[model samples]
Every structure is written in C-alpha cells, then in structure tokens.
Target: MTSTIRPSSVFLVSGGAKGITRECVIRIAQRHQCKFILLGRSAIVESEPDWAKDCFEESGLKKHIMEHLLSQGEKPTPMCVQKVFKKISSSREINNTLSRIKQAGGRAEYVSVDVTDALAVKEKVAPAVKRLGSITGVIHGAGNLADKLIEKKTEQDFETVYAAKVKGLENTLSYVDLNYLEYLVLFSSTAGFYGNIGQTDYAIANEILNKSAHLVKQKYPDCHVVAINWGPWESGMVSPELKKAFQERNIGIIPMEVGAQMLVNELDAANHTTAQVVVASPATPPARELDSKLRTYRIHRQLKLEDNPFFMDHVIAGYPVLPATCAMSWIINTCENLYPGYRLFSCTNFKVLKGIIFNEDLADEYILDLQEDSKNNDFNEITFSAKIWHKNLAKKNQYNFSGEFKLLREISPAPTYDFAKTPDGNKINENREVLIPNWEDNNFYQNGVGMLFHGLSFQGVKRFLTFGKERFTAECCWQGIEAKQQGQFPVQWFNPYAVDLSTHPLGIWLQHFYQESALPAQLDKYEQFARIPCNKDFYVSGKIKSKTDINLIVDFVIHDLEGKVFVRLFGSKFVRWFY
Candidate 1:
C-alpha cells in the first residue's frame, strides 16, 4: 500500500529515444502522474505527435522485425522500411505523438537535442525548467558505448563517447533549479566494473559514471544522481559479435521489459536509484531451460523423439510435403505431445487464428469468429448468426478478449456429461438440451498471466455467459489481465471454465475479487444438455446438477490396424456395462 504513492509531476528523460529507454519513457508516461519531456537524438513532436512515435521502436528492434518480415518477402511497412531511425523529428511522427497525448488527456513536450553537444545541452535543459516550473526527476538515460579495443580505439571515439555522456550529465545538472529536482538516474554499463575484453571504450565510459556518483550527490544535496550499471541484453544493440559470444557461452537473452520494470520500481522511491550495479534483472534464459533438460535427460536418451524427420536439427527446417497420412499425422503427433492442447489455428480469411479448441463440430463455426476477433480491435460485442434450439437468430454478446487459440474449440468438452450437483439444490443432467442465450455486457481490459481471484471470464468459452450485476467479464484486458473471476493461485497461466461460487462472501455478494485457487475443472462432453438459463437481473444461468449413483465397469482396451492398399483403419470395440 505504501508503494502506490505517485512520483512528482514532470520527468525529463534523456535518450528517451530507444531500447530500454523507450520502455522507461512508456512506463513513466503510463503512470499519468508526470508530464514527460522526451529528449533524444531521434525525432520527437510533442504538440501534434504523429511524428514523435517514429522514435518509439528502437533501431535494433526495428531491424529484428524487418528482417523477420522481409525474409518472408512481405512488403515492408513505413515504420520498418524507411531510414526514419535517423530521422529524429518528422512532421508526421511528431504530429502523431502529440495527437495521441492529447487524445489520452496527457501533456507531453518533445525537444530533439544531441546530448553530445554542450551548448545544445544547455539549450535543451533550460527551457524545460521555464515551462514545467520545477523539474522534480531527471532520468539520465543518455549513453554511448562502442565496442572497441583501448589500444586500437581512436581518440575521437573515446572523446565523443565520454564527452556526450559525462558532459551531458554535467550540463543537465548545471541547469537544474537545485530545490525542485529529487532524483537523477544515469545509465552505466556493467562492463564498466566487470570489464569486457573487446569493449574498452565502453568500459571506460561506464567506469566514469560508476566512479562519479558520490561527487554528484555531494554537489547537489537536494537531489539524487544515480548511476545505473547494466549488462548486455540479447535482443539489444543487435551486436553480431556479442550475439555470437553469448551463443558460445550459452547465455540467454535479458528481456528489456523486465529491466524497465525494475527501473520504474526503483524510480518511484529514490532520485538516483542509488546502485553501482543492480544486474538489471528479469534475467532471460531462466534456469527453467536447465531444469527442463535435467528433467528429460534420462527419458530423452531412452526414447528419442528425434526420429529421422523428427531430429532436433529439423527444428529450423520446415516440411515441404507429407509422404502419406503419417506425414501430417507425425507433425500433429509431435506438436501435440510437444505442447499439448496449446496449438493455435485459423479457419477464416484475412486474419490470424488463436484460442483453445472447444468441440470439433463447434470449432468448424468458431474458428471463423476467432479470425474475426484477431482482426478486430475491441473484443467485446463480436456476435454471430447462430441456429440455437433449431432456431436461426442473430445475437450480440460481449466477452472482451483477444488472441484465438483457434485450437481451443477442438478441446471444448460437454460440461453436462458428468452432472455434479451444484452446491445449491438444482438438477443439471446430460440428457437435457440447452438453449444458447444472449445478453448485454460491459467489460474492462486486463493484462498479465497470473491467476486473478476476482475478475473471471473465459477468453475461449463465451456461450454460457450473460450480462448483468455478477457477470463474468474482464476489464483492462491486455498483457494478462483477463476479466475473469479467481483462478488457480500462484500459477502464471490459468483458466476456469464457467466457474461460479455459491458459499463465499463475495460469491453471494457478487463483487469482483482477485485470488488464486488451483481448483481443477470437471470436463465432460455432453451431446445435448439443458440450457443453464441466466436470470435477466444476474449474469449466468442458475442451474445445478443432481447426483446419481450407478454400477459400472472401466476398462482400457488395445486396438488393431486394418490395412488395405495404402491406408490403415485403427479401431477397437469394447463393452463396459453399467446400471
């Protein structure tokens, strides 16, 4: 609770143009507590910001995405194709940025400056003070670290890198009104302290930042100047040599988003974030890889999935054609076992496929909708014409979600097959067929994968839901925020199918509460069942399953393959009588 206090009103971010800085800028702006003045070498436009957005994607990220697209021979998008990376401020990108801020009801001012220049530095820093009144925090993200040897490096390279960083720091500090600013963050490299073999110039520059932290604090007691030392991230700098080195060392990629979050967490409380070297965690290629290898090492050697075509090297290669039914079957089999029940599919035109499989018969119709959702921005209110109860009708329903596990419908089990008694006294049985009801809904988008105890809605299954006071819906649905009620606690990825509670306090009261429960779902496929009818005043249909006891036998059977000219029919018939 104490951590929620918002920071000061204005934040000045240097190097707000790219990489980890981009995430930093975004995170700060997202807080909506401060007006962001983004200063960078790239283009930025504050007032009418169509152009400033050009700086959002870093050059390295752009290159990765472009290469990925171009390899497929796709027509390049304007954001990726043009050398706009060099264009700091364009009329268009700047205008877009400004427009976006205004639309969001936020304030932003952009100043493009070469932090490398001292006079330009004073020029950029002074005006910000005059406009914002008192600049409370300064994130000294400006940095330049060229990979080179100390002996082979030219004097210009050293001077250019150091002057820009060290001088930019001095120049930024000089212009500040000592009373207002509270914290200053400087981006330093871990190489400054640890020292890499080839990056001597980079190492020296980082060392300077590390060494100067104390001097900065003494000079400005009213504010904090922190030098943040970071390690190399895999998807960054796009360094081929570094990439090769990492591969050889078997180092994993450090996600920029993780590093950005850590930076924000530190920024919220202090001026400098006060660290010599914090490791900039959320370290990538987590130990899970090693754990996974160790877990399968024995079994892997015993039963190798790497048969001829299934070999490990076949990973990067795609199959051109199938030999027979075994060809597609092998792929399905491999993929199924590799990531069971997690494959995505597409069954429509001009859109992507996603979501978990529900039922094969149902999936035939559902995939088209999944494609539609992939193309549509808003997840709420996407409807369809359905033949419900043998009646053809058009119905509108809302379940705010995105991404289709187009494969999900294939996995949909008939909930009515095993009619367990609801905590309340109501009979829900498999023999009764139900009608799909329609209703109105309002939802908020959510983000993240952790199980939410409160907001509960199934992204892949929406047929059983309705709109009302206790409706299952997610708000702020992005990242992992699903508008669903409680989930299996502590687990990252969880989904509760048509889950409703009757005994809990929030259950009866019907308020949104988030918590995690590893409660297992009861899955059964019913050919037809009674409709769980939703009361107009509430969300879901109030139906309960009645219990029954019967004598039965369960048996596991083996099958035989009937081979003809080319194909084989594999099946078996077994009897398990019940009363």
Candidate 2:
C-alpha cells in the first residue's frame, strides 16, 4: 500500500464548486492544504450587481430582481426569475468555496467550462495545468438527473443525463498525465448498483463510471483508484417528496458531513488493490426478481486441474477422475442460480455414464443443458432435467452425466429415521450375522495394497463397524481437509466429500470379497433431510438388495447415533470397469 495524498498534491476536480462535491473539496483542503483546479458549468462574476445586492434574504432578492425587470419594460415570469436566481446563487457559492479554501490554507482556481464539451474542457484544462504545474489526482463528481420512466423518456433526456457523468470524465482524463497521477476517485450512485425506478438513464451513466474505474486500475496497478457507489444523501438532488418516499420504503439517507469526510479519508488512505466500492445505506431493497418461467438453458465451462485443485487429491489408478458428487453439485448450483427464490430439495436418476479422466487431456471443455419439466410442476414444486455433455476425440457429442432436480419455495421439515425399516421401503432383519472388518492399521485408503486409492483430502473413513455380503454399516468422520486452502471446492450447499465417503463401504466390500474394483454407475434418487455436519461422526448403513454378474443394486441411509436421518440414497447401482 502507498499513501494517496500529500500537502503538495494537486487535484483536478469536476463539479467541485457546489452541493455534495463542494463539501468533499472543503474537507480535502482542510486536511492536506492541497491545490485544486475546480471545473463547473456555471459562470462566475467577481462581484454581485448593485440592483439585487441590498436584499440579503432569498425571497427579498427574488422580489428585487422581479421589480428591476419590470422597470425595464420586461415581463417578469416565474421561470425568468428562477433562471436569474440560479445564476446569481451559483456564482456566490463558487466565490464562497474559494474563500473558504484559502482560509483553510489551500489554493484553488475556478474554471468555468461545460465538461460535456470536449474541446472546451481541453482548452480550459490545458491552460490551468500550465499555470498550476503537473496534475497528481482527479475526483469526478459531475452528473445530471432527468427522471422519467423508460416509456416516457426521449433520446435527448438520456443524452443529457449520460453526457454529464460519462463524457465529462472522458474529456477530463484526456488532459491528466497518468505517470504523475496517484489516485482517481469516481463518484457513482447506488441506482446503478441496484436499479431504481425512473432513473434508467442516470443508472446507465453511473454504471459506466463504475466499470471505467476497473479498466483504469487494470492499466495502472500502482494507483489508488476507486468508484464509490454512494446512496441518497440528506441534501444534493434529494427533493422533499423523494426523501419522504425513501423513508417510507425504509431506505436510509447518508448525512452530508459523514459522506464528505469519507471522501477525504479515502484520498489519504493507503490501499490500491480495491477498484470499486459501495458507500450506500444497508436498508436498500434487493434487485428485481428474475423470470421464473420454465425454459431450457445451456451453460459452457472449461475444465482443468489448475481451476479445480480438489481433483488433484481425487485420483484413481494414477489419473484424476471427476467425483460423481461434484457433477451433482454443478447441476444443483446452476439450477439454484437460475431461479432466485427456489431451493433444490432432491435429485432423481442421477447417472454417471462416463467419468471425466484428467490423464492425457481427455477433455478440456463441457456444456450443461437443463430443461424444465413443466408437466410435473404442481403445488409449489418445480422439476428440471439436466445433462453434462462433451465431445470425444472423434468430434462426436457424448454425455457424461444426467439427473433430475426438484426445487421448492420452502424446504420441508427434517425427516426422522425408523429403526424398523430400511431406506428402500424394506423391513430390517436385525438378527442376521454380519462381519466386522478390522481397519485399526488405517490402510483402507492407502495405495497398492489398500482397498481404495483416494489421496489425503478424499480419505475420510475413520473406521468401519460391520461388513457382510448382503449388508454393511460404518462410522465415518470428515478427514478435516483445509478446503479454503484448496480454493473453490469447499462444502457449500451440500457436503460432497462426506457423501463420497459414504459410498466407500460398497467399494471396500466388492474388493474384499469378489476381487473386483467398483465404481458408482447410477443413482435412482437422493434426498437431503438436513445438512450433514462435517466435524462430527455419522453412521452409514448399506443394504445390497440384489447382485448380478455385472452390477449390484444397493440402498443407503445416513444418520446420527440417535437415528436422526440426514440423507437417503435409494436404488444406487455400482458396476465393474468391464460393464
């Protein structure tokens, strides 16, 4: 980090002579005693004219101006009086700001130029830079407001609002020397971050400033550049009706003093990595909802070990294979993002037709296709079928994974386990004899002689309780992998590592009895009753319903010691490599 401000710093500030920007400029002068070249559209006079000078109050002054206009045989309309008053007020404010800055031990020069005019800006700014020395920083706070609904807005309205913020910054940046620049502060608005009614043009302008900050920072990594998305304040463009509307909607207003001080402190701060920030009130409402209509959608993604580091520890037979659970996670995460308020409750018919192997670059890109099943959606339940596809070396499209996901507006209550029944609707036979395997040496997941070949992060089996040809039960705990250090594969909506570990009993049983390596083939259904705690021990019971020469069908119930069910996997099928 490097310091952003100094006593000798020179700043070029637009719209720094009035309203919110004026407050910020005064604070910067008080803190650093820096010199400024302030730009505005209003022309300034050195002294007020004698006709309206004697009236001290605003009402008295307006009356005096109207009277003087009438004496000159001119009609004194309301709009004419207002126009003259605005010009006079603007000049007085600019003069007062310059006097205040001087009293605060800083120097300022006011340049009257419309920033939207590129030629005027260049001519005025170049002369100011020649007189004041090289520029060091810039504060872009110029903007206009033309509030109208999109249907009622004209092209002129859009241009007026857009040019003040976007074109003004562009014109000003043409004159500054980036080699000498240390900080760039862009004053955006919250309307751009979260859309507000009747501010489409205003939002578009501010949003451009937000994106331009990032582009500039990318080119100048050493500069402290930031775009503040400020919310509505107590003054400065806040009308009385608008303020009342904000209060009714529970949106907080930023105080003038607090907001101005925040700007000065940021210039003096020592951070440069952050390119954009939001200095708005927290009570703002969320953005508009996305369309919930059922439709087919496709998403594309590139796969590599560098992007998914968790796969480095999920190797099989000297090659990294994508875990079946991760494929399911990709589907659920995508589906959840598609619909804003819906949550995934269950999945059905999830099958891995082909496993993705990272040896010799089998594939680098994949596409996920999701189609909504509108016929089955009823009573607040929505369902979608999803598939992951890739092209083989022969350039033919092939699918690797497929599943059906169910979503609901509200999650159902957590389910309770029945000790008398199995997960696949079968009666439990408690008196059957079972074999308890001895894994005290902890070689179950080790290489070569071990039953499984998972690396450090994937080996989460603490111990096994019993094993049999027909059934088995185990006590397993998470391996406590530092998922944060591994990056994006941490446990999010569901714990994939824990579910992967639960399938190990079948793998171990197949290897121990038949001398055949087993891999998951298809999952008929999976329902989550509650989130599985990764730090605590849990129990897994697997029942082999039937076995053929090529495959085995099994059911699983995962629960705690007190039989509180966390998840159920029914009609899962595993097969050998030959199948």
Q: What is the lDDT of residue 225 in candidate 1?
A: 60
Model 1 is weakest, by summed lDDT over 10 consecutive residues, at: 555-564
Residue-by-residue lDDT tens digits, candidate 2, 36-138: 9999999997678898675668898899889988988999999999998888888988999999999998888999999999999988888877877678989
Candidate 2's TM-score reads 0.55
Residue 243 error, candidate 2, Å: 8.9
**TM-score of each model, in listed order:** 0.40, 0.55
TM-score of 1: 0.40
What local distance difference test score does each model get?
A: 0.40, 0.80
lDDT of 1 by residue, 1-579 (tens): 122223346667777645667566666555554566767776543353233333455665456546656777986697555654444334344445545544544566778888767788777767866786566667777777665767788988888778767887777767666555666777887667666666677777778887777666677655656677776665446488776765543445567777777676776664443445546432222111111121110001111222222122111112211111111122222222333322222111111112111122111121112112221113211211111111112433321112212222132222321221122211213522121111122111133122113223222112222222322211111112222211111111111121221111112112222222121111111111111222211122322122113211111110111101111111111111111
Query: Best by TM-score, which number?
Result: 2
RMSD of each: 21.7, 10.4
Candidate 1 error regions (>4 Å): 1-8, 44-85, 88-106, 218-222, 234-236, 250-252, 270-273, 280-579
